[model samples]
Target chain A: MTLRGKAAIVSYGETPVTRARKDKGEPRLSYWEYFAWATSLALKKAGMTTKDLDGQGLAVMHPEVDHSLFLGVEVAEMLGVTSKWIITPSHGGASGCVGLAQAALAVSSGIVDRVLCVIGDAPMTYGDTMMLTEHRRDFEKPFGVMGPTSLFALVMRRHMEQYGTKVEHTGKIAVTQREHAVLNPDAVFKERFTMEDYLNSRMIAEPIRLLDTVMRVNGGSAFIVTKTEEAKRWTDKPVYLLGYGECNNYHHGSKALSDATLMGIGQASREALSMAGLEPRDMNFFQPYDDFTIAVLMQIEAAGFCEVGKGGKFIEETDLSYRGSIPLNTGGGQISAGQPGLAGGNLNLVEGVRQLRGEGEGRQIQGAKAGMVTGIGAVQYGRNVGYNSVAVLGSEL
Target chain B: MSRFGVKEGGEARKPLPYITNYSQGFWEGTKAGELRIQKCNACSHKQWIPKAACEECGSIDLSWIKSGGKGKVYSYSIIRHVVMNSMAFEKEIPYALALIDLDDGVRVVGQVVECKPEDVKIGMEVEAFFEDIGGASIFKFRPRR
Candidate 1:
């Protein structure tokens, strides 16, 4: 079903994501506290309050966090309104975008309007207990694959073997994002980097240098979705979701080719673009997943931004240094913005909304209109190829 | 230990178990000095990295076909460094990581033991040898013996 002219994201909000947490002295707020503040900010930005929310949803990685009751109940109770729908779509990073699609469906179908989607967490303090790792208690969690980093490292090695891409080429992508992040004060990494810094960094996994991986940060981001007509009452700049698509493949198998390439994202992006009546070239900006530099390259290539095996070349030609030719990660992405796992994709979505609204701070893309956001979740160590969710956001409203 | 190049009269290697899965049978056969792979009867799918069912089809009907364990190297990498807490790989620096394409159209990834890293090459014929790693028996490749 094409959301062709039906619904749009009127406003998006995120709390300041800095190294030192944002909290008042007396008693520091918990992760949930930050989530509540961010959710309120998003609703307020859209010229509404929790009072306008008739539906609530959460996208998170931890199942034990009681995410449903935590965010859903709190938002509902704060608004003093009972919600008919409570959605908690948990699938790692992709959960945020997936939850957005689900919420959009609810809004479009008249199940309820004004759905608030939230994903936030404090990984630094509780991620070990909160995260699902190879050493964790899950049945297939062992197998020596620690987290997304190690798993992606394995895939990077395989891709290198097949495509003959040099490790230095992969470093270029990371270095470029670092350069972009340097310009974004809200970004965790504010220092400029040379390509040499990336290449000289310690190798975490073969072909995956320290600069290639994302740091775990404590943060949360949120969005407010309502019908287009209702959204127009709130904000003039409404980024409409033209299309939504998602797909997955077997994640746990050892087949190097299947594990390394993200065929799922490619399939989803194709369907999403087709539904939106747009093409890859029509996108003004792209917020490809940057959990790792290679991941970004893989997604870019898979989405037809460039031919397979040419992602590195695409990066070099784009002049991705600080003020790039093709501006990417204007919000510093997960690489430099501190990846809060499930909250990472929400960060991307929030930034996409900001860009479409022409309000990205420090590194806003000039006159940005059409934007694409893709989320990659559940690295290949699990039961299936990572799930991918792609959304096309445009400034048509 | 001599199979992987320790001094002629070197001390016995550490205890290890060959990872026994559905593939355990083939590993056991190799311990008895034979190389075997599973061949699916329904779809004629020859598979390495053994499984209970054919990946192409859900058929559990498979037969263990003895292989010469000889094949061409499909790809390779040489590790020149080690990270912290890797004592088990202490003396194996500059080791070769290779993928071997069996004549039966299946490929397996493992280190090529008993050969210098520089000597490894794509399309070079190699055979398998069982190596013990932290009490786990792993299949490693070597220049055809």
Candidate 2:
């Protein structure tokens, strides 16, 4: 009943990260087109055709988007692939790992052999700003608590008050990740900025400066999951899914605000690592979601990399670059590599698979056998994130 | 309406609330200059933004109770940039939006008035105040001196 060493990711693919087509003067591709581009690349990498996919998992860009454009069945029909099993995980940022876990279960349970998990979006053409204004409480919208920036700023402010965290503490993350981005050709931001630049950046929301936020880009990412035994037939290096756990701390029936400092990643990581029979120290690299730098800090603390409320010190003392003791976001993460709507959530997972598969050309961690990736989902009424999903990947079973 | 910003001329075009059946009581209470939240009669657990059933103990028997309108600031953010296209908040840049932990054990989000954004701090005592904007009573908070 466990996912440990049962299913393995054989291939990962993604379109080049870029500005929206409308912004870059290119013909805009519909969501389905982008999905196909990424899917085709993954299938090619796996040395398989459309006929090999018997299971599919997809995630819509946002809950407010039209169902016709984001449904799993619609995507299947558009791609001309019939699947025995289909699922549309709607966990927002956590959809990437959550979908992977679901697909692993399907593959392990003998329901399907290969499952293609893909997500893509055209935020620029589809009025992405409107999606931010939807699904909030009746009282929160009136006060301009609309987007993740403002909501995450609230969490950052609380962390500062409780733990004496400074702008410099969070700034270190941006600085370190940007250094990693310099080595990544696919990253949107190639040029590097110093800590002074980050500290001096204009404030988008108090405690969260302009540099602390993620820029929305246009792209898609995908991967194929199959049984570990069958994976050997496709590729020489197959990244195994060791363990995964997902949790929703605050929902309709729960309290509006939990401790903003300690997110649900704590429990999710505990379950994931326990299932894998591993600990934080066993991870060669960490790919905690970076929708905001504070999120990464919270995940680092919640995932047991460091003590709660000591994230500021952890960032200050640790070397997070590719060659550091604890490498992080070696592909620059969403902070430096532009966030491409829901697809941005998959960046960490894709990078983890590549590093484990020995495909990291320049930024590969030496002998990286195991890695961890985490995702944070929807913001709940500017109080806290609703979902947390964590997964552990290893080079071998 | 009580102005929180230094520069003032245009009417605030903040997005208004679309009241739902579960939230009508809360909005009605704001208009009447009272802070009302839901209290589970079975478990005595209080909650904000009225709900059909109690979040704690899953009891259907709930009652509306008027809160004391006084609490300490749990956390806050100063919005320096106005990203929303709404012109209503154009002049209200650099405002402090706070999460106030109500004395009734419920948290409410509102703008802090009568003080500069930098002056607001966590755990600062605050009291609720209402402003009638275009026939809608909007709730805000002011630092307690």
Candidate 3:
């Protein structure tokens, strides 16, 4: 069931990430408008046009907003492209990667020849995040659970309790990613921060600090995928889709109980690696979906890059910069790059493709081949770890 | 009732819990000062989030049972800031919110009362106690004697 070498990412497009731009009162482009704009950019880079795309895909985490519902059906009306196969995933942060997986399956199954997967949102400009947290009000919010920082603070505390992980460990990730952000032209937070700054930063929740959180920005990213043969003909340096795995509402036991410190990536990554015939050690780079610093640590351990409870030591010893071993979040993960609503997952996925194509330009990982990109969905809930998805990609089949 | 937020006339206004038809019995049990959860009749699985059908066995045969209200802290987070998200908990800054693994093999989250955030431990034994808040019986945990 592996989608190996079936679909390949030939081109990618990204909009500049920004917060409330005072000069422009509010964003002029709607969500689908951003999609059309980014899609045009992707098509231009690929030397292709909308007529070449028979498949269309997008990610919408919450349909709480009216425009979000039936978004897939509206793509043709918005982009004016005829879509024979359409996919719209509702996996929250995981939606982008999950949509990629579904598109790959549809393309491989001969349902569609060329699929363009685009993810974009303007929560900063158009929507209120408080409206999206409605489901939590009934069960989790009744307690003192304020938001994500508060919930992840619980995970960090448990990790510290169980593994003795320290703030200094998470500081390394924050500091390094900000350094990467400095080189990223599109990153919102381009200022370099230090361990001292991360440590002394204001605590949002007791254990989670301001530096551990990601700021929302208005942005979009799109990637064009076609048959592997066509992609190779376009460029010998095509980024092949090797494997994809997704697990939702994953918890242990018939009771659905889970260790708050662990994510479902253990099983998800295993399935991905098994399909790709690759191991955790074989991954040339890591571009994991990082809404919080604690999440990156959890994903690192759960994906078996390091043993459980040893994420602290592994990160301490590894150089995560682009030039170093196992380059992580080289394009500045969502933590430092400014998360662009549901497009955050594709940000990492697109980065993995970019690095494999040797297009990292400023902070390139030398000789990068195979890499892993991960996603986490709806993490603040008390027990259930929402959707966990992994996409394995490489320069070679 | 504990203060949620202050109104103009020296009165408090707080966001109250929404009791649904599926969870009406659970809230009723809380009102009666009992920690109640649904236990599946077919598979004997206990769940904190009550529903119409059993999650494991798919049996609609469910019954509400009172738990012993005893558990150990599985994890906890100290809330040093609350006004940023909810103005109702503005006065309750620096409170400890804990995930408890109850003796009845279920997990629940609640605020740890009668103790400082510094006093909370990972494996501390705690017992559930009810408090009237926003016209609802919400449970709070305290260090057991």
Report lDDT (Cα) of residue A280, candidate 2: 95
Q: Is the docking of candidate 3 incorrect, acceptable, medium or high quality?
A: medium
Query: What C-alpha RMSD does candidate 2 show over the true interface residues after superposing them?
Result: 2.0
Per-residue lDDT tens digits for candidate 2, residues A351-387, read 9998998888889899999989998887765366888
- Model 3, position B79, has a per-residue lDDT of 84
Task: Please report how far candidate 1 places residue A161 from its true position, in Å.
Answer: 4.4
> Model 2: residues >4 Å from true position, as ranges?
A21-24, A54-70, A129-137, A250-257, B1-12, B85-87
lDDT of each: 0.66, 0.81, 0.80
* Candidate number with greatest DockQ: 3
| Candidate 1, A1-397: lDDT as tens digits | 6765467787776776544344633233356755676777887887776656643433223322324446555655655656778776766777777877887888889877667777666655442334343212121111122345545655665566667767777777776677667766667887777778877887654556778888866666788777777778889888888877888753323342233454577788888898788898888788877788778878878887888777767766776542555556666688877786457878878888888887876677777778788887765432224678888888884
iRMS, all models: 6.9, 2.0, 1.7
State the lDDT at A179 in candidate 1: 66
Model 3 lDDT vs. the true structure? 0.80
| Superposition-based RMSD of candidate 3 using all C-alpha atoms, in angstroms | 2.9
Q: At residue A172, give the lDDT of candidate 2.
A: 91
Can you give the lDDT of residue A191 in candidate 1? 78
Q: Quick one: ranking by TM-score, best first?
A: 2, 3, 1
- Interface RMSD against the true structure, candidate 3: 1.7
Tell the DockQ for candidate 2.
0.52
